[model samples]
Target: MAYRSQIRGEFIRRYSECKAAYLETSWRMIHERDVKHRALNTEFGYPEPDGSFGIGCKSSVDQEYKRRYDEIESRFRKPYDDQLPALHRWALENSMSVYECLLMDDIWDDDLKALAKLSTMEEDWQFQPIIAKARFMVARWKEEHVVGEIQRRVKIESSHFHYAAARCRNLLGLKPWDLAAQKAIFDYGKEWKSALEFAFGSLTAA
Candidate 1:
């Protein structure tokens, strides 16, 4: 397998950067926005924004999350639109479930096209350099999907094992043994895929 050193280097850098971002995601980042909505508002009504602060009674907070979810999803589509589909198919066939497929329906047909366009891309992307491209796709889509899930999870969602592929990057690389050295460097960060994994993992387990 032939690999472009520059592309491979870019992949390695991207992988490490994404991993660092994942690690940087603190509990504060996850919940602060929700908490601030509660603090800044001053209303009266059962669980109304500025009304109630309790977890169960906050309809305003629920609506806020819904709005944030919509915005987040719209942003997520840009990346999803670019992610490679063959990698998605590979992960889906190997470990993903039907619920995952359903949950992953693009917010619109454009997202669907993003997932399907791979079949007809240029030859190198479609066939000759599949594994290398798949590596790129797995990493690419993994980020897109993870960011999407961070904002929401429905009854239906898909499983993600791209990190498994990420780990097997060596086997998936250009040479039999001369795989990119960054694979080892980025291995731990790839576990962030587990967050995306468990999001859909429960879909199959159920």
Candidate 2:
């Protein structure tokens, strides 16, 4: 959440400040999330969303940011209100369809939009619920991707050959064993299994 807040909070500074180091550092962390996001690709019945941690979350967040982006663009090309509702409705409808989105898609969308509105109105000063959603999304997404990435990693790279323990540490998900069986037990745990694999690395049968 700290990282996320840094990214969003520093948005204006990111664009205007010549010496903004927070955005740079925060981006580095987001790259790590990109690597780990591979794990959650198949778990949710679809692949991971393309883009950084900011874009890796639900589509509502994407749409919310899309609106922000549009508003930014409107600084040069503002559109009339007549078309706003239609566009918003279209985005809301496709933002995260039940056919593709979570079970609580509406709830999540509401929370995200409310937070975005609050942040914009408060200009990053009044930040309570905004921080909460930020934390929730990052922690939840990271937890999910860990297990999936590990299972995929182990199958493609697992070997008896000795690799540097430290270098191999990042690939902890690359366990050595029946990936199916390991996944079966881990399946029930979802994010928990992901956390374990992330911590343990390459599950081995031996």
Candidate 3:
């Protein structure tokens, strides 16, 4: 059966792909703007209408600066803008359904929103309970399964060791003086010791 974690992993993979595209475009825009902005400052001799020249300086050249910045941004942004329709199309076509999305973690809300907008899905406000329920269920099932497995293995190990020890003793008729019989019986004890260790050690370490 498919677990919530497995489904969430798949969603994160697709969400990451969409996020990378958004980040790459944003980074390119910011980098180009910074480079051109510095050049603009130099071209205008770093004008300062307020008589200050460091960060947050206002300049008399504001209009010209805006014009140039807009030009640079528009040039870099056109390709991304053009591709948005196709991006949205892909997001809608391949994005997880709302049911599958309910299995996702809330930590992914921001990324999920970006993809959800592209896919035209409801935002977090509309589906808050989905994530809450998903988180609760995943936690519940994890606790149940882990505890159940540990209990089960412990019982099996105990039962097998008890039966093996008794059977070995019964077959021996009396305590064996020979090394072969001694080795044979001790082997079962060694094997069950390992099994018991494994049963308890299966728990997560703090």
Candidate 4:
């Protein structure tokens, strides 16, 4: 019985140690995430007068604009400060594990599967690389879907039958008055315009 008690006490001690380590690591992770968020905002000039990273069209010479921009930027630069603490509280209330919370938040992906496995074993393991990779994936996703869709719409809206004909004539090294160029232009213009119109409607509906 004494031996069993000693073993049980040892188990309890180890469990306490693991819990403490996990909590410390989680707090550190939260801090690191906040630091990273601030760094990204700074790098992008987020909350700038024009827009994040000065993406807005406001002129720099306008004193009023600059003043408003400065005020807005200051307000938005620490956008996540309040939310981070709330997130921690929510996780605690829900009795969610860190990994479970991360998965629920859609922060982890298949690429981090290995890191996730390691995370279960080692509380102090840094997942910065995985987080960086996830950020890159999000950027690529935006480029492929959001930016690509916008570009496609712009092309369809700006293109005309005449432009297609002109392009064909140029490619064939034919003058504007050439019979072949005129025929190609006529056929291509009709086909291209119809196709583009259909695509435009479909994209608009989507």
Assess every candidate by TM-score: 0.23, 0.18, 0.37, 0.23
How do the residues 1-206 of candidate 4 rate in per-residue lDDT, one tens digit apiece?
A: 11111112222233334444545655665565555544445554555655544234244675665565565555545643444454444445544422222222323334344334444453433333223333433444445576467545536533643554454344344675677446644543444344444444444466
> In model 2, what are the clashing residue pairs, if there are any?
39-149, 40-145, 172-201, 172-202, 174-202, 175-202, 175-203, 176-203
Task: Write model 2 residue lDDT over 36-73, tens digit each, in one string.
Answer: 44333333333435532332333344555445444433
Count of clashes, each model: 3, 8, 0, 4
Pairs that collide, model 3: none
Could you arrange the candidates by lDDT from highest to lowest? 3, 4, 1, 2
Pairs in clash, predicted candidate 1: 43-50, 100-157, 100-158
Regions of candidate 2 where Cα sits further than 4 Å from its true position: 1-5, 9-107, 129-131, 134-206
Q: Rate the local accuracy (lDDT) of all candidates.
A: 0.37, 0.36, 0.48, 0.43
Winner on lDDT between 1 and 2 is: 1
Report the CA-based lDDT of candidate 4 relative to the real structure: 0.43
Q: Candidate 1: which stretches are off by over 4 Å?
A: 1-3, 9-14, 41-206
Cα shift from native, residue 57, model 2 (Å): 34
